[model samples]
Target: MTQKSPVESLIQLSAFDPVSREDPHARMKPLREQCPVWRDETAKTWVVSRYADVRAIVSDNTLWRNGINAEEGSFARLLVNQEKLDLPPGERQSILTMDDPDHARIRTPLAKALYARVAKARPKIDAIVKETLDGVAGKKSFDLIEDVAIPIPIITIARILGVDDARLGEFRHWSEGAILALNPVRTPAETAHMEASNAALDAYFTELMAERRAKPQDDLVSDMVALQAAGAPLSDIELKINLLALLIGGNLTTTDLIGNGVRLLLLHPAEREKLAANAALAPQAVEEILRYEGPVDITGRVLSGERELGGCPMHKGQSVMVVLRSANRDPDIFERPDAFDITRKAVPHMSFGGGTHICIGAPLARMEGIAFFSVFFQRFPTLKLVDEAPQWRTLPFFRGLERLMVEV
Candidate 1:
């Protein structure tokens, strides 16, 4: 057996690697320190790891999400290709995979409607969280991911989308399967499941859209229908595609936020005690958790024109993978970056990416997190982890646990 060079080892490092997946900071710290803008020849992409570099790349408007210069087989190209597969020919891509003009056209109305929905849904979100916790009240132990984390967001988003309680389970199933679309290297079975879920969602939403068109209800679907009827510049296809995006985005990532926050609090009892002592600390603790262990891992961009980043000269049409988790832990920006301190002053984290393409669902995710944590510890004062070792999911570009078992 031959020992690989340091650069080779770093090049081989991937989110899918079990060791790296479980503890990416260990692998990423070396990469950030040694080569902040390292190019992975195998993936034909530049990997930006340092906080400053990632911020610069994301903040630059010249960088494109439409994959104009993205190398073949690169993560950017994979995302673009997947979007192509999901949409019909000649249709605009979802805001997640498109540049401005089209991206803004679709995003503005959706963002407006979503913000309004989330703003008014706070009380409902709290009620949902309390009701969800109430569901597991008598149980001595339960999987936090399934019992608490999963239901709150799913139920909330379902109601927002006009999906009734009767179909919450089906809505959840589609969301779980459809989220596989984010995994660039999904298996054939996973791919099939994703497609099936997409198909089911398409059919369901199509019917619902027609119904909403005929009779507008007081929900997101109806809100969108009203927006379109009032000439909001969104087409039917874009509306459906983005609705699907909101559904998947709103559920899984928020689920992980709750799950990861609980795990973090459990692991750091002192921090938990502080939060338990002061409910006002819940919002700050949520931010700390987002910084320390965010759900999404990497967001990338394709250079629209030739540009230099992190002292590295890059060409037109080249892709740059911004490691958000790595940036969150960059020592240059974060003091004691590796330590989990819930009371740390709120520093903006790259967990929700940055700039124009920042995750639009972020406010709502934060709301869900604050709502969950505000009452969770108070309700289950005796909560503790069943397993200290977390079982992280293997899905690339996503950092979430497969399960978080706990005793209350």
Candidate 2:
């Protein structure tokens, strides 16, 4: 047996390992320095890390496609649906996975509806943030991720989607299942867990769509059903899949965003104080948290045809995982890419991704972030982390803490 060189060892590291998941920056630093477009032979997928390369990879669809759409796929597959399992019969593809005309059809109206929700959600979101923050108040310690971060957006999105408030807990469980299913590598137990959760989510959203069509409500599901009834290019399956997407995508990322912000603020006490003194800097702090360490670690596109990207040749049907976390830290774009500075006047990172598939819940998430951070600090000015080293989950596509315990 031959000993692998250090560079070879780093290059061969598994994306789902504890080391990569815990500190991906360290595993990816040498790659960014030596192989900006690193290819994993075992996975047969290219990993692009540099900022320029990630951006180019996102827009150059002529060289890459979205979603691994298969004949055995469903009418309600997510934008990054790579699951192979039992699904209902219907022709479906999410706007996140589609290109051009197909994507435009669903995205245009969806954007309109989402923006309306955001426009009216500011006051309500503030209330939700305050209510969630209140739960952690007058307490010596609490799990920030569970008590504060998760509930804010989960409750907000539940209200927006018209799901019974009692089911908010169920939403988190299902969303976790949905996200865990996205892990490229899953154990047999995880597979069963995902299947069960997927079945429940699909049924729940479909039933909600039915109820909305029969009796229109002021909620988002009702609005989407109305659009579909009015001959919008959306089908019932598309509507349902997007609803699941919104529920999981909207709440999960925002939860991590809050967690990331709180963790960073706690780690950097001075910067936390800066935001505490000035409420207006909450938004900037949130943005910095996103750039420094976003929730989504990686996203990819399917190659459309042979083309040159990031000075590398690629063929059709190949996929490239653009590591957004790494891209955000590129020295070329950010002044001190690694530093977590609330006052940094930096260009936006690929936190919400790029191109047509940018995250739809960005505005709501921002509103939630600003409100949560501003209110949280105001309530607990001297909040501190209960545990300095919180464990992080090893999800291939997401970056978030398992538990962030803090105290006042």
Candidate 3:
């Protein structure tokens, strides 16, 4: 019998594979221990698995997100799509796909506006959570994903963005479709759904912007419009695209965070009791949930210059796939990493990517998690998981349940 090489072994653990998707840690454990860094010739990329290695790669600014220097047909180039170079700057990329000057230019104003909005949004967030839970009250059995996790973030973010309650159903549908952007491998139907959502968002924002200009209101959309009018360095298209990005980013991940956190609490009744006994533990529990099963599993970077990582020689234009989940679970970083302990004091998790490109909406997501968990168990003390073996979504680079059925 022939033994599979490390590269072959790594390649087989494709994110699209069901077995890998269901329990990636089982496949990642061996690689993290033995082959921390291995170049997959098939994908023409370097896969980094260990905690230290993943941290170094993400923190290094030398590796860029834009893939401007990437070689043709390489993973980096494929990510940015060099073919779109001729398009307008705003038309070509979102803040996630930009580097340095362009990234800062757009990120600055957006972050200022978003952080300001989120800082004052605590009251609104609590109200939204209460309202959502109110809807699920009196139900004997319901899907945590559909009934609770999904609605809270969508409503909270929509309110933040100045979107009206009347159009919330549409916003939810568009967000569901737009989240397909996170999936690298998409079927034809998925691609179409994403495109349609993008188009709808563009049109809606365009009209909304015009309205805000005509009569500015006291919401995020109006604040952004005022900033642009005050000479912020943002194009119309850039503003629209980033707003769409925020809409999706603000909700989808938070939804998963709530779902995953609740599931963890259900799976470990002792932990739930601990949290219920002391609401102060909610914040720590949220961090543990992020470390254990974050919504995002992987993030990538393209090398701008030749460099070596974890004893492996890498070249300019090569891509590095950072396995965030693996890094969070590395035994070297967290004691008994696989075990979920809200009280554990350890290094910060890589669920939110590090460095310049760290998630801007992380605070908002964290707030939502804390708010949801603090109230959820208290509201439904008898809540219990109806399905022990809940199904996880097959989308690569993301970790979320398709449905978390529960009874109250």
Candidate 4:
């Protein structure tokens, strides 16, 4: 039998394929085994699988650079709502796209504030979850995402940001547009949606900041406004973009996490029963869910210098796609990598990423996940997945569904 070259193996590999997105482990296992750092000739990108290589590459800032195309590469792509700005040539990028001191500069101002807010969000999270669940009480059937998963993150984050509930309709519409901006293979309609959303986001945040400055509510925007007022170096655009990034970044993936966790739980009945029996296991269940079906399937970086990864030489200016989802299921690191066992001990996963660019919203996401599942399972103990073959959004970069139909 003849073996294909690394590039040849990846020549036909397209991450956007529906089959591959539905079953990423099956698709990635071969590449992870034979070509952990395969190059794609047509796309001119390197693909990194395996836990060790992925962690090493993302952690090493000197070897790789972010901030190129914010939508396609870096953590920026995970949760984004962007507009093509005509700013001065040296205008700064969002913190998601930034590397080193630049990224740290923006993150430092709000990092502590973000942690504090999420830490204090428990009572709020519980209230929101109960309220959200209460809304669907009479319905025997409902879309998990629309009725359950989506609202928890959006409403919770909105409350955290002091967004008026009346504006949520507009906010949800704008957010839909923003998510499309992250699609690498968006259609003309999707492009239009993204642009429209970007404009709305800018206007909405501008107005929000103005209002916060006048009234100073007990919320995230106010916290940021306070920091800005206190001479913590922040530009108007920086403040707006950073806050928007936080909003979208926190909501997008967390929504996916909840929906995915529900799907995984339904698919594995024994595990679901175990989680239902003991609510305390919800935290570990969240970890297992993340490992099995994470929100962000892939993140990327651009090579800054000639680097060797997985014994393959890659030159500067090239791009690398790091499959965080793939690394989580490394057979070497996991006893039964493919199994969805909620009781599985936590052994770290790349769903939240690593290094300096690690997700600032990790704690909030975890807390949300634990709260969401614990309440959701308890609320609908006999909830049935109405559509076993539920539809999925065939997004290459993001893993989520259009709807998760469930019978309460």
* Candidate 4 lDDT, 262-319, residue by residue in tens: 9989989999999888999999999998888888877767777777876678877677
Candidate 3 has an lDDT of 0.83
lDDT of 2 by residue, 1-408 (tens): 022212343223334666776677876676776778765544556677889989987766454344553112311123443453344222344565666666778788888888897889888888888788777677899888888777787788878888877777887677667756456568988878777877888898888888888998888888888887778887777777677767667767888899988898889988988998999998899899898878887777777667776567876666677878888988988887878899987557888877777788888888888888776787888778888886776655677888988878
**What global local distance difference test value does model 2 have?**
0.74
Q: What is the TM-score of candidate 4?
A: 0.90
Q: What TM-score would candidate 1 get against the native?
A: 0.93
Per residue, candidate 1 scores C-alpha lDDT tens digits across 321-365 of 888988999888889998999889966899998888989999899
For each candidate, give its TM-score against the true structure: 0.93, 0.87, 0.94, 0.90
Per-candidate Cα lDDT values, in order, are 0.83, 0.74, 0.83, 0.78
Give candidates' CA RMSD values in order.
Answer: 3.0, 4.3, 2.5, 3.5
- Backbone clash pairs for candidate 2 read 64-302, 64-303, 65-302
Off by over 4 Å in 4: 1-15, 67-92, 185-189
Q: Give the lowest summed-lDDT range of ten residues in model 1.
A: 1-10
Clashes of each: 1, 3, 0, 0
The better candidate by lDDT, 2 or 4, is 4
